[model samples]
Target chain A: MNAVFQVNNLNKSFGGLTVANGISLSMEQGDRVALIGPNGAGKTTFINLVTGHMPPDSGSVALRGADITRLGPTARVRKGLVRSFQVTRLFSDMTPAEHVALAVLQRTGRSGRVFGNFGAMPDVMAEVSEGLKALGIDHIANHKVSEIAYGQQRLLEIALALALKPNVLLLDEPAAGVPQSDTSRIEEALAGLPDDLAVLMIDHDMDLVFRFARRVVVLAAGTIIFDGTPQDVAKDARVREAYLGNYANARSSV
Target chain B: MAIQRAIAAEGKVDAGPNWLLRDLMGLAAVLAVAGIGYLLFPNNLALLTRITAIALLVLSLDLVTGYCGIATLGHAALFGSGAYAAGIAAVHFDITDPFAMAAVGAVGGAAAGLLAGAIMLRGRGLAQLVLSIAIVYLFHETANKASNWTGGSDGLAGISPDPVFGIFGFDLWGRTAYVFGIAILAVVFVLLRLLVRSPFGMLCRGIREDPVRVSAMGASVNGTLLRMYAISGAVAGLGGALNAISTQVVGLDSLSFTTSAEALVMLVVGGTGSLFGALVGTLTFMWFEDFVSAINPFHWLTIIGALLIAVVLFAPNGLYGTATQLLHRVWNKR
Candidate 1:
């Protein structure tokens, strides 16, 4: 379990309200870790700081054992890190194929060429389709991003991130707002990623989290209350207290 | 990538069959009319030259507001700077050749664009717009103060754009002027057209749609935007240089807010996504401005304002895209 991302003594605040306070954790490559917490406990903020969405006030975020505390989101992705938004960020008018193609173009660095020469390139479209197929959304390649269902948009965004071939993928509430029927499929897909690819997710769905996460870091009040395997996290007294509801705690255990 | 490339390779826009043919024919017909107008209204050839020059400037606005998705109302600063560059060359160095002025103007405009891009790209949306507008005002102030070269209200005059081949001069009838401008327009339009259809073009569209996703995919939002801004400015500069040549005068009007607003309105009226839209917008705008002004000078404003409102309501995609969209819908309905 090589640590792919290591955060130490992290703190972030927006105009004096602390969003992430002194958070320290290490996520191994291929480790599915659910960062669970109440709605403003900085679950999203913490993930954002790690992915370079916003610079932290003070702390270090190391990827593959190298500190990237100051790297921007895009630069971090080049070092094998990628993230999807909490709200779906697909191009509403663009086809799904067009969405993935742009990602591939960025990674492959083919976008800068004069327009006259690029469409003739044979490999670009293949990569676009391959990415779509991997995410099981190739059937919707021609569909506009706006036309897709909420669940499919999530997968499409994931495919967009995957097109970059990042080593560490950040999924913020991968199952948030998704239908109950789609939860298991989403979970299985998350769990099926390459073992060497690291994933850290912020999901409120404890059942889905427990099923997919080998390790869990339960956040409360902008700090980690529990960091252990799913079973240990379920047994932690503080984790139970923080959830503060029988159904939630039971869902975590299951 | 391969399949998408295959889709793009055919240059088949879902806009439907014969669209390109229709577009090219339209281009040819419009150009031929102008070409014939050159021979017939040699007296108004100078005005036609002005139209060609404005087309290039409007095309630059198309790049920023259309392709890069940064709606700017301060682009006239770039146009003015370009005109000043050519003006200064004509006044100081006695360099009055249209090509030389174009070179200087493009460089000046590109420099302003690059600087503006760096300062504004990170600002995002409304910030970028406000910052750009501020920069234009700042430049306009500088131009006003530096009256020694720019001629203040009178503008830099007596600057003539020497005709190409040296054997000819800009005749009073504008025959030489028309030939010179038409040639430049042909090249600029073709190049911009090729650029907008390419992967670079697609990426710009992608950037406009979602810069966050674009950045995460490793496209440097700032860099792409910066280059785009500079390119747009250079085009504006070329237009300015050509304007200086055809009119044999440069005015403070080059930097006026009205210039920027009108070009933008023209872009919206014609459509942004298409270079043809830029050309169409510029032509329609100037044509209407001329026609309406001749009928009732004070009333032209109301007419133009109403036209803009109608465009927004009836064709939100603007003229070119809307027309194609409508055609597609009808075809599908059939």
Candidate 2:
């Protein structure tokens, strides 16, 4: 099977601090991969390099085998590469409906229309409604983002990414600041994503990583130390030494 | 069930009738105000016409600085370019038809917008603001140096536009000019209302809120802003063309730094990001300035400063913005 998303020899450094070091990764359609790492493991940096938010010092990124190493973040997104922020970055004054609607319009290249309201466009609104509903955020679609809960805002971020009709979705700590009670909603939303869409999630929650990921990739000090099934990840000596440590051993014992 | 709930939520927030009703009411209020001004200040139609022209300038300024969140203090560059273009067309090209002149002006303004957007959009915040200031000075100096065309500091005169459909002469009493200005303002206001509510407008609002996120959403931040800047230029140019027609003179003052600064001040006083606020601020500030200066010419600046301070302290959202917020609160209570 061909990989839908591919990264080759990605290398980045901020002066002496190397954020990404010769990283090569690929995912087939419908692959659920969790990127796990210790603090400053370059997880977010790797995502940034792939998404074209930051330039890689020496590497190439490709979506469906088409080279996009030099594309800007906006161009990358246009090519079906979409990402959500680690912290919920939402338009404070806009409602969830407006947020989703913008993504749909942008994805369809109808955002440049100088006349006509998005609300009046039945097709666009339908898609917006569907996207929000998928994430269980339809109830708060009309409420301003500032007025909504953090968990709902996080969900809206995912809904926004989904609205773009991404073939490969990169979620950066979607439930980072979400309360313990609100994490399940995020998990459900993650599970509800289209089965054929590839997802690479950067997360700290081990339970979420174990539950959502069929495959796990661990990064330590800017290098991929382990890449295999979740079942074998806990048993990898290097991953256990570098990141999982006792947690992996504890899970293995259970 | 989810789709039904979604539809119900949308209905509750923005029903078709509610939007239509609000637009109609807004249009009515603008016309009503125009009518009242016609009745109350018949002798001062020229002043009213001047107010109308400046109001357009402020409105255009709001599009870039307010809607796009681009900090620019030299928007008069667009306004002045429009005025000069219209003036030059009349003197050199013999395009004295008022509509034609307005078109010429709009084209000129848009071209200038493109130029300004290219330079200013390279940087943001304070850097953009400084670049804008530099741009206006450059335009002002260019107009000054090109004395043969722009009349140098003497100001360009002899802009006699053929009357509206060649029926109403631009009389000294300023009757036609005032009505013409109002009509144009009304049309632009309506079009801008549609524009601000459109998908492009939402994208701009998104850009304003967080440009990085908007870019992440696959919209080119610079491209969107440049388009808006050009649109803003067209609006301002239309106003300048009107000024050239009504007043029959295009001066270096049109492109002056003071003009740009005044437009910014008016926008702030009225509120940014709201079209109605632009009009309200322009009318209120100009009228107040006229009234206060007439009453106490020496101390008027002090009084205006006090008024600004008061508005900023009490209604930080500007007068119209605060009023609308209060109205919304009252509306929700009922």
TM-scores for the candidates? 0.90, 0.96
Superposition TM-score, candidate 1 onto the true structure: 0.90
RMSD to the native, candidate 2?
3.2
- Name the weakest run of 10 consecutive residues (lDDT summed) in model 1 chain A: A113-122
Model 1, range B157-247, lDDT digits (tens) per residue?
8887776777678778777777777877777776777677666777788888888777878778777888888888898888888788777
How far in Å is the alpha carbon of B120 misplaced in model 1?
4.2
Give the per-residue lDDT digits (tens) of candidate 2, residues A53-120. 78999989999889999999999999999999998889998899889888888988899999987777
Q: Every model's DockQ, to 2 decimals?
A: 0.46, 0.60
Task: Please state the CAPRI-style docking class of candidate 2.
Answer: medium
Q: For this target, which candidate reaches the highest DockQ against the unseen true structure?
A: 2
lDDT of each: 0.79, 0.90
Model 2 Cα lDDT, one tens digit per residue, B1-334:
4474456456543445576687778789888999999999999999999999999999999999889999888999999999999999998889999889999999999999999999999988899899999999999999999999999998899999898999998999899998988999999998998888888999999999999999999999999999999999999998888899999999999988999999998898888998989998999999999999999999999999999999889989888999999998999899
- The DockQ assigned to candidate 1 is 0.46
Candidate 2 error regions (>4 Å) = A244-254, B1-14
True contacts kept of each: 0.64, 0.72
Residue A147 deviation, candidate 2, in Å?
Answer: 0.5
